[model samples]
Target: MRAAGFAPTTATYNVLIKAHCSDAAVPIDDAVRLFQNIAKPDVCSYNTVIDGLCRRGRLPEACDLFAEMIANGIAPTVVTYTTVIHWLAREACFDDALKLFDEMSGRGIMPNVVTYSSLIDGLCKGGRAASALELLDRMVRERKLPNTITYSSVIDGLCKEGRLGQAMEILDRMRLQGRKPDAGLFGKLITGLCDSGRALEAANYLDEMILAGIEPNRLTWSLHSKINDAVVKTLCAKGEVSRAFQVYQSMRTRGISTEPKTFHLLVECLSKKNYLEKAAHVVRDMLSERCIPERETWDTIVRAYWSKKKVRQEAEEMWSQLTVTN
Candidate 1:
């Protein structure tokens, strides 16, 4: 352009830099070269360069450019502050991001919804769901209603942290506000319920999703399996062997294949209750399917025999056979 009698201003370079910075598929070196080519760089140029570096995960270089901008008496815009905050958030550096946010405000830069949303997301993602909730309260007190995405993100985080009740409360609030959860948010809720041993509630939620005309995807199916496994394990742990066995059998009728872990857990549970005969039969079934019995399997049977004062010799013989065959 310069050779074609067209002069490129600092703003032109800044625009080019910003464009390159936002393109995830673009190389960072290209943005850096464009910024370097700018002569007599202004605030926009510096902001563009700093944002570009941060976007490329070059935080140190971004900081250096920020410092240089200040040295040159260039005031940063909201976009510049946003770039730094987003970068820090992405790195899980919430403290630094919050400090930068405060500094931006101290410099009289008012944050928009995007800034607040990003900070809230960072806090939630960093496992600070409590803090995120507090921040959301603050936002509400200041008359800023949360968007659906913000609500969903915080709900997902709370659910993942085992605060299923709190997450449900949020979901209820969302519904009252006439906002519905998308598939992803529904998946998270189901997963959280299952993780908390609320398999029945998880199943109910799945039914609710169906009633709402939402089809369960692979993720929902995976959560169903997890919830079923947890229920079976809990039943077994409570010495409800017959119930666990019934649930295991019902899985096949539901088209859910019996996983290896399910067999292991059930066998171990039966053995613990002095049902070595039943445990051995289960082990035989496992081996019949070419699933080699784990050491824990042998140990369970041995302990079962020892518990009943039956025969350590038989236990030893079984152990020897397991070692040779397995």
Candidate 2:
């Protein structure tokens, strides 16, 4: 419009304002300049600049602009107030955020779900989980349905804080309310459960994930491998060598391929059980399969035979074979 050498009317300017405000890469200063460049500013133009600044967490700048707009006889709209309030919440300036909310309500600008969710996210991040819970209740009381984004934010926060039980409750509530959890949300839950030593429950979710057509990625399998390896090693250290070998065999039969670290762990477990010959065989197979042994692998092999004087020559020959491939 400006390129056409035609002055934009207030509505046209408002359209430009909205366009510039939502563009993340466009700096607030550029938006302000565009508004100023207009021959006459309208409420929409002012609102757009204010919203852009507030959303970017420039509260003082937004407030200053709001004051200027009022002075210039441009009345603030509901969208204007909400944008500033959301910005305040993002900055964890809850007091200012709430104050603005009250002011907006007094001025007949009714708050909505966007307002509540902003504050809820802030509260959760501030470690005020109880306050966030209360805000969720308030949203319901205000007849605002919590959207998937709102619920997901709370769930993510809970998981990060290790509040898995509470997170699960929220997850159940979300499902009951007909909100399907996305893959990222489900993945977080699985990771949290596994980390908390609830692998049995994690296993159930794996099936649920498959049934829901959520493909498990490499990360999922990586976590599973770690948990299984830890359990197997624990069993082995407690003198359950047979059980440890069973675990290894199960991994092989299930096509759950492991890194060389798994083979190293197995070899260590076998050596501990006085199965040096079996351990040597495991090491040779690992090398024959072209799995690069770590420095620790060679150290383990050498040390396993060091205490027995009779097998020193055999250990040296095995070491030579291991180094040739490297």
Candidate 3:
């Protein structure tokens, strides 16, 4: 274009420099050379080369270019600071990142959500969750709301540190502010609870989670099933068959499918305890869900119902429906 008498504008030059920085075949040195040859290289020129150098793990060189940019009176933007902060965080160089963030702020570059997010995430990953929480408070004071990743990182750190009560508080606070919990968040809470031997608390949250209209993913569903089964087995073994039946019914209504063995054990226990109709309902529910009870399960249910003369016809009808459905 220059040979054709069309001089490249500064914007055109910036574009060319960015193109060179992005091309792996063209080393960042080429882009730097091009930047130096330009009559005036703007902040974008500095940012492009710094980012390219950071991508290739040339942080020392990138910092040198940053210094040169500052010495040349080209002030760095939030993007400039964020790129370096994020890279430094990922590389486990938190002290330098923090100093750079402070310097950027001193230069009147207000950190954006991306900047705070990087700092918070990096702090949490560096085992400074308390500091991350402090930063989150500062973010709120600055009227900069933390997003999901921000909250999840802190919650995860709390859980890993076994500060579950505090974690639950944060979870509730997020809910009060209308940031609905996702399946991943609930899964983390549930796993943490189970690990702490507070599975019954996990069960309560599972119920609340489904009621809140969040569908559990595959892993969450599996954990939920395990917790519910534990509850049912505990109730049955304690001779609280009525309560156990109620839990069983709740599981069915929630579309939580348990194994045939769970139903069989519950029905057999209920029959021995003279809860004939509840036993019949359990068998009926099993057949409806295509979880066919074994022959012995059927025999116990039928014999228990036959012993109750008045409820015999209803039991026989339920049995007939079960057979036809199966």
Number of the top lDDT candidate = 3
- Show the colliding residue pairs in model 2: none
In candidate 3, the residue pairs with backbone N, CA or C atoms under 3 Å apart (3 or more residues apart, or in different chains) clash, namely none
Tens digit of lDDT per residue, candidate 1, span 1-326? 97999999888888888888888899988988988888878877877778778766799888778877778787888878877787888789888888898898899987766777888888889999998898777777767777778888889889879998899898887788787777667777877775776756665665566468654356566655654566676566556787676666555445545568878998888887777777887788778778888898788877787876448767788999999999
Residue 173, model 3: Cα distance from true site in angstroms: 2.1
The lDDT for every candidate, in the order shown, is 0.77, 0.73, 0.82
- Number of backbone collisions per candidate: 0, 0, 0
Off by over 4 Å in 1: 22-27, 40-44, 217-326
Please tell me which model should have the higher lDDT, number 1 or number 2: 1
> By lDDT, is 2 or 3 better?
3
- All candidates in order of lDDT, best leading: 3, 1, 2
Q: What TM-score does each of the candidates earn? A: 0.64, 0.64, 0.67
As for candidate 1, its clashing pairs are none
Segments in model 3 whose C-alpha atoms lie over 4 Å from true places = 20-33, 216-326
How big is the positional error of residue 63 in model 2, measured in Å on the Cα after superposition?
A: 2.6
